[model samples]
Target: MVEAAAPAASVVETVAETEPPATASAPAVVASPAPSAPAPVARPAAVEKPVKPKPEARLYRSRTLGQWIKRVVLLAVGAIAAAAILILAARGVTTLPGVPEFLERYPGEYHLPATAEPGFPWWAQWTHFLNFFLIVLIIRSGYQVRTQQKPPAFWTPKRGGKKISINLWLHQSLDILWLANGLIFVVLLFASGHWMRIVPTSWEVFPNALSALLQYMTLDWPVENGWVNYNSLQQLMYFLVVFIAAPLAAITGVRMSEFWPKNAKTLNRIYPVEAARALHFPTMLFFVLFILIHVFLVFSTGALRNLNHMFGGTDVVNWVGFWLFAAAIAITAAAWYAARPIVLAPIAKLFGQVSSR
Candidate 1:
């Protein structure tokens, strides 16, 4: 065994050279698995960022213009009533203080004082022409008879005065025309049945009148169908204006002629000439009163509509009649101015000094 060992020195060195190299020089560092982070707690799906709700769009509404127009019409109706009160108040303010004594002293001769000027315009002249013609014819003829100390023979304005011939002819012509016109007009209204519309259908006119009176007196209006409306009272007023007042004017007008006024005369059969003339001035006064009232009511009811009818002729419907009153007013005013006697008595008395010789 000793001999074999001794022989291996070089060979042993060769064997050692064939072995693999050692890796002890590099050290390996092991890190503990990072402490497992606490498992995330599910927070109800992150609350979805509360998606703020979008606001909703708003809607608005408006009224139609036609509805607004109805309100205007209502206001217009109210305005008419308001005007009546104002007129009555105005008349009271101006006339109350001065008229009482005048009325008491001269009931027969009393009339509304004349305006400062005479004729208003052409319209007035045409309206009042008939009245002017009739009155003048009667007055002129009467004056002629008085002057000559005999009864008037003519039924028209005599051929006398500053323009007697012209006045006489015109007066005579209008009389015939007026008669025919009146007959036709009256028959037309009555025949068409429009006149019946104004008549009260209810027998409660008196009770209705009472209630209306109370409301008027109390300054408290009661609205049923509408407020402060006219009942029988209004109907009567309408009827009187269309029937009584207008008819009286025509009837008495015819009586101005001797052909009409004489007893047993054709015209006299309808109305006595003397009686007609007697009522003439008074009837005029009544007409004036009516005119004042009618105007006031029209203004009160609805000034615009009333004026439209009075000045422009009936409503667009043209059912209502046109007002020819302006024509009459003009003639009356012009004649009144021309006929107005100068109050020269005072000056005459002062200078009547017998002209101082």
Candidate 2:
């Protein structure tokens, strides 16, 4: 029994020695991974820039008084320089090429006799004043109408259909009145035998006008005898104003108005709106120039005498004419100041439909 127990114990010990430890024998279990930080988020690309918008176009540009004054000064200077150059060239300046021989011709060769006559009559004086008043109104309204991009007030005739601006309505209304006045004046002038003063009987007036122009440029104005006879230049200018420029202005103005034939496409195509516009604007400028020169001469030559002829209807130099002239001028100035849109709108409403745009 001892030997059998010893053999059994030896067998057990042998088996234990052959087998590995329980920890070594067990399968290896992977350790649970440690929790990791959230993956870094990708940043967005740089924001794109916005595009800029384009600027709008302008219809009219505003200018300062200084700029206008500068422009006038420059224009005057240019005119004077050009006149000087022309005169020098005409006088056979060796440096000047292509100078016309006619430029060198003096007006004395074509002068006409001054017909002795009484100064301005009462009708003449009254018509002159009327013309002056109408012209002033016409010019003011015309400028306003021309420059306006947006009409503050629009006008339509009682008949309706076509619409016109208040400024233009005023201009056209004044124009109609002026035309009537001009026609009456013309008729009266012819009946009174005063048409001879303005109308040229012969072609000789051309050279005389040139001479007068030369005299004016040289600061040697022609002898003042408007009471008796106007210089050839004066007569020509008056003729042009009365016959050419005035009619041109009227015609061009009408062509632009509603009165013109709209459906006359072929006629319109031939006599384009652009042509009428070109003629009209320049005609207005011509009238402006004539007024400026006329006023300057009236004041500078003999204020009292000139005033007497136009206002008092006499050749006699007196303060009575001057006083009347001053009063007329004052009235004109007041009218000019009062010619605002507020005032003009009411006047326009009487003739047509007036409404704020």
Winning model by lDDT: 2
Backbone clash numbers for all candidates listed: 20, 0
Which candidate gets the maximum TM-score versus the true structure? 2
Residues 216-256, model 1: lDDT tens digits? 43334323211112344555665675567657766666566
Against the reference, the lDDT scores of all candidates come to 0.47, 0.82
User: Would you estimate the TM-scores of all the predictions?
Assistant: 0.37, 0.73
Candidate 2 residues 1-357, lDDT tens each?
Answer: 888799889999999999975697678778998999999999999998887777554422566566777888999999989988876654544234532344446443343435524467788888888899889989998998888889878888987758888778888988999999999999988887788778887787877787777666655676777876787888888999999999999999999988899999998998898999999999999999999999999998999998888898788988888999888888888888887779877887787778886
Model 1 residue-pair collision total: 20
TM-score of 2: 0.73
